[model samples]
Structures are given as C-alpha cells and as structure tokens.
Target chain A: MALAKRIIPCLDVDQGRVVKGVNFVGIRDAGDPVEIARRYNDAGADEITFLDITASHEQRDTTYRTVEQIASEVFIPLTVGGGVRAVSDIRTLLNAGADKVSINTAAIFNPELVKEAAERFGSQCIVVAMDVKDLGDGSGRYELFTHGGRKETGLEAVAWARKMAEFGAGEILLTSMDRDGTKDGYDLGITRAISDAVDIPVIASGGVGTLDHLVDGFSEGAADAVLAASIFHFGTYTVGEAKDHLARAGIHVRR
Target chain B: MSKTVAVIDYGMGNLHSVESALRKAGADRVVVTDMPDAILSADRVVFPGVGAIRDCISEFKRLGCDETLRAVIEAGTPVLGICVGMQSLMTRSEENGGVACLDWLQGPVTRFPQDHRDTAGAKLKVPHMGWNRVRQISAHPMWNGIDDNAYFYFVHSFFVPADQCDSVVATFEYGLEGASAVAQGNVFATQFHPEKSHDNGVKLLSNFLDWDGSC
Candidate 1:
C-alpha cells in the first residue's frame, strides 16, 4: 500500500490579495485567496498551497494573516510557503491551519533549517522548495535558483534535493524557472531528475498550459503531485477538468 | 422535489464541494446530513471527505450509520463514498500511526505501490496527479453512460487494495497498477473526484443513477 496522488492548486498571495504572473512579472490580480481557495475546494482540489512570493524580501507585512482567512474557510488541507524562514514561522503557519510549509531560499542559505523544521514539526510538515533553471550551456544540467527565482546559486539542483531528503524533508516542490508562466508544459527533465533523486513527494510547478502538460508532469516527470498557475488563475482549465483528464490518462486521482 | 441525495457529512470531508458538484451534475436535491434515516431515505447516498482516517471511522460509529449503511446496501440502495469515504469501504485503514476501518472488504488501506518501476521500468510517482485514462473491466452499474478508457480526476495519498481482484471494477496504470474503481455488489467507490472530473464525473454519477441491476 502507498499514498495516493494529489492534485493541488497554488495561490500566490502578495500583500493581502491573490495574484499570478509569468517569470514573476506583469502580475495580475487573480482574486482574493479565500475566494480562490473556495472555488478550488468546490472544484475538487485535493489540497491548496499558498506561495507568498514577496515574503522573502518585502517588509510591508507583519504576519501571514491572509492564509489564516483562507485556511479557516476551506475544508481541504493546505500548505503555506514563501519567506518561511524560521521555526516560529512554521509554527505560526501550522497554528494558522497550514498542513505544511515550503522552504526555498532559506533552505539554500542554511541547509540545516530543513532538518530543524522536520525535527520540530515532524518531517511531513516541511517541504523543501527548489527552483531550478538550465545554465543553457547545452549540457542540460540544472542549477538551483532562490528568492522567488530571482537569484541563481551554483548548487546543482538534484544534489540539493537529495540533501533535503536526507535531512528529512518530507516533500519537494520543484519549480522550473524557465517554464514559469510559459504554459508550454512542465520541465519534465528537471521534474524527472529530482523525483528520481528523492524518495518523498515531488510537486511539479510552472509551465502548465493545458491538461496534457499536467499529464506529462505526473507520468514523464514522475512527480508525486503537479502544481500549476495561469490556467487555474485565468480559468483556462478548472481543477475538475484537469483531474478528469488525468483519470482518463490512467493516473490515480481523488474522484 | 429537491432529489434529496443525503450526503453523510461526517467531520472528515469536503462535503460542500461534493454537494455543489452534485448540483452542477444535475442533482436537484443535495443535503449534508448524518441522521441515519435521512441517509436511508435519500434516493442516493454520497459520503464526502478529506481528513484524519481515525476521526472519520469514529464519527461514523458515533452517528451509528455503520449498520444503517449495511441495511441500505442490503436493501439494494445506491451509495457512493469519495476519497476517504471510498477508502472506508475497504476492510480497514492504517493511518495516524495505525487505525482500523469498517472491514467492509478485508484489508488495511495502504499507500500506492512503487512496484510499477520494478516490474516494467514504469515511472513511479506518489500522490499520482493529473488527467489519466481509466480502463473499465467488469460491467458495473457506475459505468452506465461511460465507455472504456475514459478519463477522470484524482488527488490523494492513500488507496484501497481489494481482497479480491474481482473487487476491482476499473484500473489505471501508473508505476504499478492502481485500482481506480472498486465494486462489491451495490457498494461502489472510485479513487478520483467525479465532482472535479467534469463530464466524466457526471457520466459516472448518471450511470449510478440509471442502474437497473441487469448487468
């Protein structure tokens, strides 16, 4: 017996509202996080992940109160990420009703943070967030990017993921910076690489243009989960339609 | 008439969405109630959810619907359990360290296997996601308006492994073979969310609605 696959929709919150963009630019107001979560809950999203893409650098905030509003209203489980830098932040998110927290730049800056989060909140509560990109030198090797995909670190993405798993990070949220908002499809090569390197769950994010992209992300990428935007935010593809397409494609999903 | 499908809202589910989906699926009557008789009297029953496995099994017991459900099925009534509700039909489940279930089938609910890779070099991914095809096997009532290899939606971390291969009415291949739908007489369940699955979801429900027991 093994865990079931998950279909998760991501909500990017800035200040106190829901917004989305490609390459993290030209952002558009999507809607209220609470409203967006409610619709996805109704549409059959298994879980919801909130990415505070601005949390790392912005100081215009005191706490993640928006997540509380959305989590309180939604019945499904939730994962909160972005600028999550400390054990207290993890506790705050959990106390605020998040099922997990995704750590990105923080984990890269101090790899030990993953171990500490896992030790404190249990491994299942800590998700190692990895943003990756190709050097474009033609070797097809990927390097880790951090700070909401704005900074590139020379660390090999796959090696860092393996390290996260060893430190007890229960899951991995792998986003391909090159594919962010391209809607072309997921970066299967990056997703497959990390998925193969780790034993925990891998959530493939970015480049979800159509239903087929999601399909390829799950099978070809070997992702335990698929995370998307644009389509979900712009309403090009509803969660239910995505699930049905996956189900018909021979993927196991919650119906 | 509201059609009145009594959805068992046992603290363990996302009953709201299932209810909304039913409404969107042409279900005129949808009520989220756990009163045993309401569940019994409804034209159909839907058990919706997303929560701790332990709390749910206990909630069903507290509401005393365990035997009521057994009676409904004995009377040949139609019922459906989404996610954990679907998992509930199996013998038992292993979660929160360890917990037991209705034993309706005969085994503990377990994680999806990574065996697909070992057997065929198939891709192995947990919490398998996205749109995948479902291959129908036996002629179950849930297949009413749907065809073979039709698609549906899914999201979960665990599944039901049947006591009998015959228990599986439909299956989808991932790294290993995963049971997408299971049937034991009138009791039916799926690993995907029909409410979120669009037309395929509606068709499966409609099939359950039109079942005449001829197959």
Candidate 2:
C-alpha cells in the first residue's frame, strides 16, 4: 500500500489558549489547545502541528505544559513550533513530548542551526517552516518572510526550501502569507514548486477553506500533507469529515 | 506479580512517549532505564532509539547495553526494537559513514536511494515520514488482533534488507520492498513507531506485552 496523504490540524496557540486568525491577523480564541488537540486525535487526525503564536519567553513554559498535556492524551505524532530558537529549545520541546519541532525565524538567521539540529536529533525530527509571500512583481517568485510574516527576507522561497532540505530538514512546513487566513485556498503555484524542489515532505499550510481546497493542495500542489486551523477550529468540518472527503476524492488518507 | 517491561534508555529516542504508550497498552510497570540489571531482569525489554546510528551505537556500547542486551536475548526474553533500535540490530549500517551494529539480525541497514521514485515516476521523499501499510508475511502472537496490511507511523531514511526472508514477519513497499517488521524466536523489531501509530500501534504494543516469547 502507498503512503497515505496526511491531513494535519494546526493549533495556533497564543499565551495558553488556541487561537485562529486570517491572513495572519485578527486573532480570535478557539478553545484550549490541549482539549482541541484531543478532539482531533479522537477524530483520526493524521498528525497535529501546535504553533505557539505568541512564542514569548513567558509563554514558553505554558507551551511546554500544553504540549505535555496533549502528548499524554493524543496518541498521534505532534509537532510543536513558534518559539523554537536554538538547539536547547528543540531539546526542551522534544523532552516535553513533541515528536518534531518546526524552526522558522531562527532557521533564516542561521541556516546552520538546521544542519546542527538535524545532525544532533535525526532529520526526521527537524522541520524547517517557511513563511512565504508572493513578490507580486509577476516574476512568479515567492520571498521568505519572518517575525510571523511581518518582515520580508528577500530570499527566494524555493531556493531556501532546497537549502533547508540539503541541510537535512526532513519536512518543510510552507505557509503562504498571501493565502493565509484568506480562506481562498493554498498558493498552489509556490506550494508545488517547493514540494518539487525538495526531496522531503512538504506540508501545505495557510489557506484551506474547504475540503476541495485540501484535495487541491494534494492533487495540484503535490503536497504530502495539508494543514488548516480555522477550518478545523471553528467547526466548519471535523477531521473525520475532511478525511472522508479526501478519501472519496481519490486522495488516500488514514481513516 | 505484574510483568516488568524495561524500555532500554541509552539516552536516545522518544522514551517518554513510548513508555506512556506501553502503559496505556496495559503494561503495569514500565521502567525507562539504562541500568543493565533492570533490563536483564525485566520480563520484556523494548530497545527504542532515534538519531544517528553512529551515536546510537556509541552510546549503546558506552553504557555496556550491548552486552546486557545480548545476554537478555540469549536468555530468550521477548525483545522488541523500534526504529533505530531495529536498525542497530542489523550487522552494520551505512549511516554516519558506515557504522557496525549489534549483528543480532543478518542484514545491513542502508539509506533509501535519494532519487527514489514511485511507480507514477513521482519523486518519493526521504525519511518516508507518516503512515504506511504493513503486509503481514508471517503470523506471530504480535499480529494477534491486528489486521493484515494495517497502517503504522514511520519516520526513517534507513531500512534493513533481510538476508533471510523467513526471518521477516512483515514487509512494506516504498519504491522497493523492505522489511517493515522482522521476527526470529524471541526477538521482534519494526521500522515503524507503533507508539505513535494511534489505535493500531496500541494494539501491537499490547500484543507484545502479552507475547510469551514462543515462536
């Protein structure tokens, strides 16, 4: 049997509660991160990505606690990101029960961290998260952004993705700023480009308003996994429903 | 007395999650320890590991775990190895510039070809992360309640190509056929992480807890 395409529900946590926003703005409380994660686990989510949006030093402890709680209850693989800045941060999260840790801003500042983390803790546990935005110059190029999509790095998204994979990133969490929170769909053009450029799994994040959008992410974008927050957060559809839709749409998903 | 399950901790892998899953699977006493005596005396030993093979072997030897583990196997204790734990049981691994392993199994661990492609000609990713189905090749006590071709979570770039096909209990296809699960006497190992595999994983772990080390 072939590897099943994954449907991941992202929990964007602020302080301690789960929050959802559009285009990376206008945040609203969804529920407790741990509780929401448990719901997803029971509903047969392939995996769960927990992003601590606030990611402040003060929130670090709280985030760890939340991850520990969720890990104890949820049996599926859990990936935690957002405040991870160094190897120590990665160690703490992994020790706290995270199966993988996603690195974004720190990875851009020091790509060596990607190599170091992957070398120390097998590449399977290191995820390089790329927050990307289209340049809009009609060049069909996307630029990398940092600070939660507030700062633009001018680095080409596809090139950075290739570099990350070369440096031993096992997976790429590609979040499109333009499509994020827009609920239109994934930036299929860039998603497909990065997925094709890297030899590792690429998780398409930041859009996904409908089940059809998810099918498009896998079918057109060629993403190995599709991640959505608001869609699963606000009850638009349960994870089971999404899996059923994907399965019926001819996309193999774990039921 | 309740059975004592020792999860050999050579300072690698996701020990906590594995221990928790073992507990949830009905192991009344799950001890995560590096102490050789604890592991040797336990009713069953679970050798779980992650990270580079070189580091894992160095630590395994540094802690004198190799000798103790060998002794446990010789004693006919039921042993289960996960991921790197499974890989280390092979004769050698091509990871980390070629590291020698425990040689408990007759195979060499090799990395998946970087340019591996599916039948559709699509480039398959390394690490082979996420869920894939395992086809049962030989029935054992561990396969008790689990369905054939059941899906399990996997996260690895290296796999063991069994030299003896009869030793392989199950196999999975990913560009090429490889042993996803192998068994011989009291020893069992899997390339997949049953702890993180949700229901199927729990069921397998529970089966291991109940296994009597009889082929």
Stretches off by above 4 angstroms in model 2 are A21-30, B162-166
Candidate 1 per-residue lDDT, tens place, A1-255, comes to 133467888888777667653222223334567777777777778778888765444552433667666654665557888887877777777666576789988898888988887765556567898889988999988999876577889999899998998896878999889999788899999899888887677999988899999889988988888887778777677788888999899887766
Using lDDT as the measure, the top candidate is 2
In the order shown, the candidates' Cα RMSDs to the true structure are 7.6, 2.9
- Classified by CAPRI criteria, candidate 2 counts as medium
lDDT tens digits by residue: candidate 2, A1-255:
379999898888887787653221222323677767777788788999998887468658888888888888788999999968899999999989999999999999999999999999999999999999998998988999987688999899999999999999999999999999889999999999998988999999988899999999999999999998888777788888999999899998877
DockQ of 1: 0.06
Residue B169 in model 2: lDDT: 89
DockQ, candidate no. 2: 0.72
DockQ, each predicted model: 0.06, 0.72
Share of reference contacts kept by candidate 2: 0.65
TM-score of each: 0.63, 0.96
